[model samples]
Target chain A: MRIAVDCMGGDHGPSVTLPACQAFLTAHPDVELVLVGTADALAPAAAWPRCTLVTASEVVAMDDPVEVALRRKRDSSMRVAITQVKPDATGLTRADACVSAGNTGALMAVARYILKTFDGIDRPAIAAMLPNSTGGFTKVLDLGANVDCSAEHLLQFAIMGSALVAALDGKNAPTVGLLNIGEEDIKGSEVIKRAGELLRQAGAAGLINFQGNVEGNDIFKGTTDLVVCDGFVGNVALKTAEGLASMISGFIKAEFTRNAWTRIVALVALPVLNRFKGRVDYRRYGGATLLGLRGLVFKAHGSSDAFAFQNALQRAYDAARNRMLDQVRDRVVSALQAMPAAPDTARQAA
Target chain B: MRIAVDCMGGDHGPSVTLPACQAFLTAHPDVELVLVGTADALAPAAAWPRCTLVTASEVVAMDDPVEVALRRKRDSSMRVAITQVKPDATGLTRADACVSAGNTGALMAVARYILKTFDGIDRPAIAAMLPNSTGGFTKVLDLGANVDCSAEHLLQFAIMGSALVAALDGKNAPTVGLLNIGEEDIKGSEVIKRAGELLRQAGAAGLINFQGNVEGNDIFKGTTDLVVCDGFVGNVALKTAEGLASMISGFIKAEFTRNAWTRIVALVALPVLNRFKGRVDYRRYGGATLLGLRGLVFKAHGSSDAFAFQNALQRAYDAARNRMLDQVRDRVVSALQAMPAAPDTARQAA
Candidate 1:
């Protein structure tokens, strides 16, 4: 398996990406990496086993506009890396999957334009995995893809998310939850209400396991295996959780180091505290996949270190190995067909 | 000052509400409490001085529907408690403020119908106080009142939230942050985009101290004094934060009691950990105010203890004494007039 790495991406470019790729190559002996960035910057990483250095002149900055990244920087490392996954004229594949920790909007823009969205999937959804109370990950979608979504768009997210979970976790009928304010039928906006109806119909038709509406707390509770939401709500929920976890961790550290007496107590409590930190570590969140895309592309945290970035690469390798894209192709087709012809009209009439 | 206590509301009924009210009355020598519920249930609390027992035949169950609570349970403890604030034929008020922990939706429905919305405020907002990094509370409105909101509705929330913060905290200028997926101008939905424009214009006119767009993390970071979001988004964020805090606290407890060695360490660490827990205590959250209403009504957590419920009553008493409703009325009028006339259309044109 060959994974394309956008070396000139994230807060720390080649300095972080190079070491991550090297470690990933060492761990996964059968995997090769296509390191795409400036030649000189990626020189140190060339000595690593099975690493192919692909040169690109431009870099898509973290704060770059989507148009600038997508069109203006045609030779950007992000754009070039995405192109490596695109089938050539002779139909030969250079890389199985792509990885980037760059600007979310730019990465999405470049990937969508280059790989295009999968058939039946109107737009691609960004699905991130989070650790839950059940000691497993729950897949949540459209984290920051499309800010505004319609009922039909939510149905598409449900389909894509269920497929990803099923492919990766081997759950034939993964439970899909609609992220709403409440579990009651009358809760949420008109779009969510209509989406719930469509999801229910799809569940009855055996397209996806639609768990009724769930709230923000449900994501961490693992009430469902896959949670579906529009980008706006999902992004806020995801970032809010991150912020809170970071803040609490800081509080814990500050408490343990308050004074000499507390510092002695901290020495005894560090091990247990470290274990608790590991349990909720965001690094273990791995990568957020651009689900519903024609090709597999994973986005790591821009500030990720070597170990964190390696974890992201491992996720992409696993997804590629499991043929997640191929499985989603078949799943999306049937799920689209199973959906009600006019759920919006039906909900209104009811 | 007088406060109406819904004795039959919350998970604990009279057990929690009565004790809380008694404590509140004892703490505030000049304040009185009107305990509204069944006469038999209120018999014990009737012995307390300045505790007037107002009997109501109906008790609105926690799981009751909104319509049933609003119409069928007209004389419910929750409804009757709110009516104590309504000036009777003699034009005399029995209670200055009302507090209930019953079904949030039902309470909002009954309160809105009875008290009615303040002029220029299209809908009432639920404002809950959250503990920020600065050790001060940041008020966020529209917790779960209106699921679907227009751009104008968000602006109304901003105005109401700003007034509440100023009235309670005595801050002449409270910085308000508009919650979005990201801080960028290109992020969020059409409603949020237009709302941003209006908030900006209101800021220019000195109606509010708008700090532009902020993501969910900013809520905890104390980046702004107050955060304004629609009920749906605000409800989800609030619950998600609560859930995460509870889960983290549980994890800490579990880690400390894992083994004999850890348990021994826990004894030494207990003092510091307890202080940290108190810092993030949800009991400090107090009551969620039904903002933009003619009368002051606060909804305590359904599962609150005596101390928690008492804190909620304190908040209600403080609001009444400060004339929060009157302050909001004048503020809302000026704020609405200060807003740009055609922001929604202007956003679309842009």
Candidate 2:
């Protein structure tokens, strides 16, 4: 399997991605790396075996506007890396999947423009894993892809998310939960209510395992295998969790390092504290996948270090090996086929 | 000042509220308490000094629907407690404010029915204080009141939230942030974009200290004194934080109690751990204030204990003493006066 890497993306650019790629290659001897960047950026990786360098003239900065990244910097490394995964005239792709840590907006825009969405999927969604108390990760989708989604879009998200989880976690029928303010069916906005009805019908038809509505706390409770919502709500929830975790960590550090007596206590509790830290570490969960696209694409955090970025590459390689793209395509097609005409509005009158 | 208490509410009913009122009265010698509940429930507090017992036959259950709480349970302790804060025929209220630990939906419905919204305010919002890294609380509003809010409603939330922070935190001009998915003005949904324009205009006119847009993580970072969002997003964010915090705490406890060796470390680190816990304790933050109402009302968590309930009472007492209602009314009137006509659509062509 081959994975294309945008070596000149993210905060540290090649400094971070190159080391991550080298480490990833070392771990997975069966995978080849397609390093996309400027010649100067890709020079160090040239000596590495099983690596091919694809040079581009410009680099997409972390803060570049979507228009600039798309129209102006046409030869940027981020665009070239994503392009490698696009099918050629012969219906063959140069790379199985792509990984980048550049501007999220630009990446999603470029990916959708190049690869396009699969049939029965109007827009692609971003899915990420959140660590839960059940000693497993809860898959949440539409993290920030489509801010204003219709009920049909949410249904598509559920279908795509279910397939991704089944592909990666090997759960033949993963339980799906609709993210809402309350557990009741009549709890959310009009769009959410419509989405719930559509999801229930799809679940009844054996398209996906819909487990009713779930509150925000249920996400961390591991109440379901996958939690689906619009990109706006999902993005806010993900960021809120990140904020709380950060605050708690800060508070813990402040308490443990307050004085000499506390410092001694920290020494004795170092092992247990480290163990707790390892459990909640975001890096181990890998990167977010831009699902519903024709080809696989993983987005590493922009500020990710070597270890974190390597995990993202590993995630991309794993998805490719497990044929996640095929799983998504098949699942979406089957689910859409089983769905009623105008699912969002058909049951509204009832 | 006299504050009404709903004794026959929450999980423990009188077992929690009775003890909480006793403790509150002891702390505030000048303040009187109107304990509202069934006669049997109020018997224990009958002989208590500076306390009056108001009997109500019914109690609103935690799972009661809004319709049931509104139409069926008219003489409920929750209703009676809120009624105490409502003005009489001569425009004089029996109690300065009211506090209840009942069903949120029921409480909001009953409260709105008994005490209508203030002028220029379409709906009442639930506002809560979250402890931030700066050792201060970030006041967030509309925690599940109105799920579908227009840009004007968001603008109202900003005005009300700013007044709340000013009254409670003693900041004359508390900074307000529109809770959004991104910091950029071009991001978020149509409602958010229009809300941004209204907020900017309000900020320039000195109606509010609007600080542009803030992401979810900014709440804990204490980037602004107040963060305003629609009820749906706010509720989800609050609950998501709760979920993540609970998971982190569970992970910590599990790690420390893994074995006898680790247990000893927990023993030594107990002080530091407790200190950290105290900082993030929701109980210390008190209850959520129902803003944009004709009277003062606070909603404690349904599962609150004696300590938590007492904190809620203290919050009610503080708000009443500081005249938070008057501040909110004045701010809203001024903001609406300064806002452009059809603020949501006036500047769309611009």
Candidate 3:
């Protein structure tokens, strides 16, 4: 398998990317990496076996305007790495998948522009695997793709999410949760209510397993294998979870170091703390995938260290190797075909 | 000051409510509580010096529909308790404030029907005090009140939230963070972006301290004293935070009791763990207040025990004693009068 990497992206750029690639290559001897960036910076790491360099002159700054990254910097490493996944002359994909740690807006814009959206997907959604109490993960989307989504769009997200989870988790019929403010049938906005109905109908047809409305707490409870919501809500929930986890971790540390007796206790308590930390760490979950696209694209956190970035690469590799994209395409078609016909005269009338 | 208590609300109802009221009365030397519920159920608690009981025949079940609570159960304990704050004669407010540990929908419905909304406030927002890294708390609003809000309504939330923090946190010009998917000016949905502009204009006019756009993680970091968002996003973020905290706490306990060695460590680390737990405890921050109303009404967690319910009473007492309702009223008027006059040609051109 060949994977493309945006070597000039993220906080540490080549420094972190090169070392992580080397580790990844060592771990997966059968896999090769096409490192895309300024060749000079990445030349030192190209000596590794099965690793090749693809030069891209420009680098998308973390703070760059989306237009500048997409329009002005045509040769940006982020864009170049994504293009590597586009098929070559003989109809074979140049790179099976692509990974980037650049500005999310820029990366999404460039990828959407180059690879285009999937046939039935109105817009590609961002999916992140979140850790839950069940020791399993719940795949959530759109983490921050389109800010607003209609019921039809959310149905598309549900279908795409089910496909991705099924492919990754090896579950033939993963349950999908429609994230909402309340679990009641009468709760939520108009679009959310409509989305719930669509999911139910699709579930009844055996296209996907639709769990009824789920609240935010349900995400961490592992109530559903996949949770679907519009980008705005999903992104806020995802980030808020991160913030709280960090805050709690900080509180734990501060308490452990308060005094001599507490410091001594910290020594004995180190293992438990580490265990708790490991469970909530984002690095273990790796990068978020930009799903519902023609080609596979993964986004690493801009500040991810080598280990974290490597986890992202491994996740992307797993997605590509497991053919999540193919599953999504097939499932999207089936779900759409299975959708119940709409009521012809459903509008409120005299 | 006298506070009204809905003794028949919440998951535990009278069993938990009575004990909590007893604790609150014992802790405060001068404060009195008018416990509203079935006289048979609250008779034992009325023996205290200044404690009183007002009989109410009905109880609002946690699962009761809003209409049932508002229109059907007129003599329900929740409704009767809230009415204690209504002026009886000579335009004097009876009880300082009211609190309930009942169905949120039911409580809000009854409160709105009886207390009414503050002038110029389109709707009341649910404000919850969330623990932050700064050791203080951040007040977030519209947790699940108005599912879909106009930008104008969000601006109103910001104004009310600022007033809340100023009254409670005692900050002269508490910074208000407009929750969004991203921190950039151009990011987020159209409504969020418009809310940003409205907040900015309000800030420039000395109505608030707008800190621009903030992501979900900023909430825990306590980057701003208050964060305002539409109900949908706020509710998701709040619940997500709660779920994650509970999950983490669970993880900590499980890890500490994993084996003999871990158990020994847990014994040594008991103090640290207790301190950590206290810092993140939901009960410490109290309950969510129904803001933008003429009278203060707090909604305790449905399953709150005596400790949690008492915290709710204390928070409500603080709000009432500090005259939060009056402060919110004053701030809303000031903000409305300070709004910039619209340009004559600013409306969509013909």
Candidate 4:
């Protein structure tokens, strides 16, 4: 199996990416790593025979516009990294997965441009796998993809998300929840109300598991396996969770240092603190995937270190090995076809 | 200052409200408490000579609809507590401030009916006070009063929020920020975009200290004194913050009880934990005021205990002392008048 790595991506760039590639190769002797970036920038850090270097001089800045980065910066590391996955004359350039810890917009744009969106998909949704208290990870879709969405788009997201859960967590028809303000049947905006009806009808038809309505506060409550929403709400929810977690940790640290006795206690409980930190750490989960694309592409955090980058590679490897792309495509196609097209007016009247 | 307390509100009702009143009276010598509830309910609790019991027999259930609670339950304690502030024949029942920890929907309805919306104000926004990491608190308006909001309503909320912060926080002109997804020249939906322009124009005209923009994650960052948004986003952000805080506290408790060493450390760190809890607890800060009304009305959490209920009364007393209602009315009326009249050309442009 082969994976393309963007060595010039993320804050640390090759400093983290090169070491991550070496670490992954050490764990999997048969896996090949194709590092994409300028050769001189990576040569000092990467010293492995199994790793092949592909030079790309251009680099997309963290603040660059998504459209500009995708269309104008064709020679950038992210673009080159994804391009390596495209089938050549003999299909030798085809990679199992592509990993980049760069600007999220750049990564999504590059992926969509190179791999293209799947049939019946207008926009690709970014899905983040969060480890819940229920002993498995829950998939939250459209982390920051399409800001404006329709009920049909949300329904499509639900179908795609369920297939993703099946591919990643081995859950069949995972419970799908439409994120809203309340759990009541009459809650949420007009769009959400329509989405709920569609979800219920689809669920009744056995397309996906549609749990009624999940509120923003219940993201971590483990009520549903897949929480679906438009990009605007999803992005705010994701960022708010991140901010709150950081605030709480900061509060704990300040509390422990306010007094001498507590400081000593903090020293003794360092191991427990580390354990708790590890559980909530996003780096361990690697990166989010831009689902509904024809090929596997992952977006790691911009500030990811070697461990985080390596985790991204590993997650990408797993996605490739599990044939996630094929499963998503097949499930979505079949789900769309199996859907009874607007049950007769008489059935609706009933 | 005399504060009217709904002794029959909240989940614990007089059991919590009465003790809170007594505690406040014990701590604060100057303030007088007026308990509004049935005599039978107050009989079980302590009866102080300084505290006057106003007989209000009806009670609004936590799950009752807002219309029913306001219209049908005329003699409800929540209604009686608020009506005491309305202008009577001789204007004798007017309270300095009135507080209730009962159903929030009912409080909003009753407050609007009795206190009435300020001139040019369409609705009263629920401005919740949140704690910042540095010190004090930040004022956020329209928590969940009106879910679907227009640009004009949000502009009104911003004006009211700014005035409240200036009155309560002692800032001459507290900075007002439009709660948005990002801090770009042009971002967010059409409504937010229009609100941003309105705020900018309003700020330039010296009505408020309107800061450019604030993201959802910036609420706890203490970047601005007043953050304003429509009810939908505001509600989501508020609930998400509360949920995350609760989750973190729960996680910390679970972490400190894993084994013997952690338990020893927890014992040593109990004081620190208490201090941290104090900083995050909103009950100590008192209730959130319903701004843009002619009278001072505050809503406390329905599940509030004695301490929480007492804090609500204190909040009411503070609002009364500062004469926040009058200031809001005067500033809002002046600002609305100063705003450029509705443009026929602008409507055509949209």
| Span of 10 residues, lowest total lDDT, candidate 2 chain B | B341-350
Candidate 4 residue runs with Cα over 4 Å from true position = A45-47, A86-93, A131-136, A338-350, B89-93, B340-350
Q: In model 3, what lDDT does residue B265 have?
A: 85
Q: Candidate 4 on B232-251: residue-level lDDT in tens?
A: 56667677677666666666
Error of 2 at A167 (Å): 0.5
| After superposition, candidate 2 runs with Cα above 4 Å error | A340-350, B340-350
Residue-by-residue lDDT tens digits, candidate 3, B1-350: 99999999999999999999888988998898889999898888866778778999999999998889888899999999999887765857668899899998888878888988876776788999898899989899888877767777888888899889988978879999999888878878777888788889888888988999898999999999999988888889999988898888888889999999899888888878998899998887759989988788999999899999999999999998788888998998887776533222111000
Candidate 3, residues A57-174, lDDT tens digits: the string is 9999998988898789998899989998987767678789999888887888888889887766777788999899998998998888777677877888888998899889899989
TM per model?
0.96, 0.97, 0.96, 0.92
Docking class of 1: medium
Can you rank all candidates by lDDT, best first? 2, 3, 1, 4
lDDT of 2 by residue, B208-274 (tens): 9999999999999999999999888998999999999999999999999999999999999998999
Docking class of 4: acceptable
Q: List the residue pairs that clash in candidate 3.
A: B10-B101
lDDT of 1 by residue, B118-212 (tens): 76777787898887776677788778777777788888888889999988999878999999977876568887888898888888888989999
DockQ of each: 0.50, 0.55, 0.53, 0.35
Interface RMSD of each candidate, angstroms, one decimal: 6.4, 6.6, 7.3, 7.0
Worst 10 residues of 2 chain A by lDDT: A341-350
Which of candidates 1 and 4 is the stronger one according to lDDT? 1
